[model samples]
Target: MASMSDHELYPIGDAARRSGLSVSAVRFYADAGLIEPTRLNEAGHRMYDIQAIARLELVRTLRELDTDLAEIRRLLDGGTTLHDLLTTHLGIVERQERTLRARRAVLRTLIKQGGTTAQADLMHKLVSMTDEERERTIDDFWTEVGANLDVPDGFVDRLRAMRPVLPADPTAAQLEAWIELADLVSDPAFRGAVRTYLRDTYAAPEARTLATEPFQEFMHGSGAALMEELLAAHRAGESPLSGRVQRTVTLFLEAVTALSGTPLTAEARDRMADGYRQIPGILRQLDEEDAAAGGPGYGDTHGRYLALVAAINGTTGQEHDPIPYVWIADAMQAVQPA
Candidate 1:
């Protein structure tokens, strides 16, 4: 209090220069009670000490960050801590960042897909759906497929359970996958084709039945692992008739029959081999037909749907060589011990 000579103050112009704010902005903040003059000069003009200049700088910074005037006012009034304000603001920034990424993904996909009005409208609709709505869309697809069918219990649930999950921060591929998958399931033609396939195949009265849970579990679990093993063997130039490949195929067949509650009989072997033999022709027919020329082939739609699911789920291993499978089919059909 006795060191009056140590006190220094500058006028409004100097305060604005020091704080990097326009004089009007400084004055506006002052009027808004965000910052005020440390004292009045002898001429009754506003003057600021060093502390007031620092406070003015803080106000300028907050305004630059898009903090509302009232929020800045609260901060200046000591209603909240700077730490808390910044923490909450950081979260807001992160959410905005995610939103921007998603928008970027959509825009890129739109460009890649030719950007027609129809495509744009589809993107808008897909992006506009809430997570629950998207989930409901998938549920509706599975429900309609299994409706009035004699499929096993949890059959519809099994179909619905492969829901594509879009991450919080999605890649461009994932967003594109979601767009395609959602559009596919929403299509009445696709739904009808898949439903017909299900009705004719699994829902048929004489269809061989497998327990839904065990079959799915084994397929996705051990069956997947075994396929990987077979793929590795194939890559290593092992013949389908090689000891390793044959042994792995044998174990796989045994496991499948066990899961289905059936014995791996010679007749079962013939049926399975016949089934594999038919795949290439079926795939070729589906591939040859133009999807736009007629209703979608059940197999083609299912494959495309799975490819999109793989993209969305960020999984791999879709590639295969039919040659190895053909050899395997021959091995299965050959005269062998049961």
Candidate 2:
């Protein structure tokens, strides 16, 4: 053809504008062999046709997704499908999102607590630890606690199995939980509490007897439906005090009282309610003066500590709901206690 219509070709500036790239970028892509000038204009200036403009636009989009230049070229050459390119980049973005969220949570915690430089350094280090390091830390914690534990009936084995596994792409809450767990386990007090719990709760004769009670079996049988409903709420991150949770707890308490033939006395119920009310305060009163200041919230019990471990491992299941026992224990002191 002797000449081309204006609509069929674009000047370099026009092509750059249409493709959402700077003039230099369009020229660079051309130099990279990803695109090319269609022809020279009457003034001998490089120009691109409609097809070249479309290719430059695709390059701009892929680059915006953090695609490397080589990958972009592969995509241009039809060496990779668009679906493959997008799928790969989507995974990259998701991983980046988790990393950013973890970093943001760390910064937020520091900001919220007015954390010391040492605290900041520790938080950073804990969040950055390799998987092997995390496992080693957990192992050390268990080793110390295990020395005092005499739990039988596979309890010790199950407890040991619940070590943190921090997921390949952990949620913000999971990352936060792991940080607190790391801090908590590194504290001697927390390890001691675990030992004390194992001795006082699991190894106790009456506690062991209670473990095999008919009601315990009922809980896993008839009560599992209610338990699973509450568990679903927990997994969805619903507040324990929500109306739905209250209803579920009420149902659970009724079932427990009926099955155990132990009507919760009004006094016991009052004590339980008072205990539950104190939980929020107790959780906040954790070792504020130590590295574990943000440690083991939610009643500040080893129960919460274990919950954090379950969270990082993506294995929370059949979690105990403590608030309802408040609706059921009717005891109290001059002040609330954990």
Candidate 3:
């Protein structure tokens, strides 16, 4: 038609130059049926009309958006409606955007902290977890903890609810929190503490008598209070033999009795007293040696221990309080020579 004649035609080489693609790329697109040339010249060169060039530009744009050749072909072939294609691609783009945002936030945090290359590499690794990976990480942690215990009916849901959802554009604090959480879960000492708690709870003759209600209350209340008192005392350079420390221990023991709904017999109470007597020795060990110095080290041991305690007591938000199991294990390890 005369109207088609009005449109300028360019040879494949010229079209490639104008479209910012190589001739081979143009040939590939043509072969893929994405952008066909208008005609073949006398010398057998491909000739593209203005419209074909425009379509080639669109193909380039789609490629930049990471659309695969098959999808592009589907769009060109009308096998897929543009609306459907765009809707699907939108999700992909959004996910990629989230990943990029997380990476950028991590990089900014590292930059602000003047972090080492290793730290930067760690950030990258954390940011690279897919949605499935994140879900699996959370699920695995909860599953391991809940394996032996009679977790309440809605406990799993509650646990999931408590999990912090790291945003696509996470803050530096969130990133740091995630990293710490990851480290806490991954630590052998922490894992061992969790396993020990499971074993003790499952192996106990009074397992059914271990009421979750009282345990939860004690954790949030007196147990947390005791930990706070101990941490404060430890910080204040006060003697473990001090009256204040004794009073705190008594209060903690009374709370444990109240929660368990049983009176502590004189013998049981004496054993508890004996445990208190060992506190100063344990503190001395923690102060004298690093966590790695013995079979159980205190280096990061204290922090890791506290994190476990907080997690179990449901007071994990309380800073610097070690979980009881972790504290005991670390104490035992601290005494053993590496």
Q: Against the correct fold, how does model 1 do in TM-score?
A: 0.70
Which lDDT value does model 1 have at 92? 87
Candidates in order have lDDT scores of: 0.76, 0.72, 0.63
Estimate, for each residue in 10-74, the C-alpha lDDT of model 1 and write its tens digit. 89999999999999988988887778888887899998988899889888888788888888878
Per-candidate TM-scores read: 0.70, 0.62, 0.39
The candidates, ranked best first by lDDT, are: 1, 2, 3
lDDT at position 18, candidate 2: 96
Candidate 3 lDDT trough over 10 residues, lowest sum = 329-338
- The alpha-carbon deviation from the true structure for residue 121 of candidate 3, after best TM-score superposition, in angstroms, is 10
Q: How high is the lDDT of residue 275 in model 1?
A: 76
Q: Candidate 2 residues 61-119, lDDT tens each? A: 99899899999888888899999999999999987887798898788778877899999
Point to the candidate with the largest lDDT: 1
Model 3 ranges with Cα > 4 A deviation: 1-6, 103-173, 177-338
Whose TM-score is higher: candidate 1's or candidate 3's? 1
